[model samples]
Target: MLTGADGRYHWPLPPATYTLTAHCPEDGSGGGTGEVTGVVVTDGRESTADITVE
Candidate 1:
């Protein structure tokens, strides 16, 4: 997991619109793959997001 400027856990991906996703660490939780979230950031702009680990 990655920490953002927002002080939240997330995954930093390529700067661009993406189908951001997060999944369980195979801890046998049905919450595998976090809720679908999306963010549209320019190639050279700032972007951030927070995701909850089930």
Candidate 2:
């Protein structure tokens, strides 16, 4: 889990297809959640997945 003000995270993963999910807890105002699937990570390469909630 990420525990900072920047709201950034990193994970070491092997070369394969994967799925990433993020969840925001419910507050008095509101809450949201998001996910990304089919993420491909290759050896000696960089992969990116973006999730946004509103």
Give per-residue CA lDDT, model 1, range 1-54, as digits (tens): 645575466444566666566665565565555555577767666676555656
Global local distance difference test of model 2: 0.81
TM-score of 2: 0.72
Model 1 pairs whose backbones collide: 22-34, 23-33
Each model's lDDT: 0.60, 0.81
Backbone clash tally for model 2? 0
Q: Estimate each model's TM-score.
A: 0.47, 0.72
Model 2 RMSD in angstroms: 1.9
- Give the clash total for candidate 1: 2
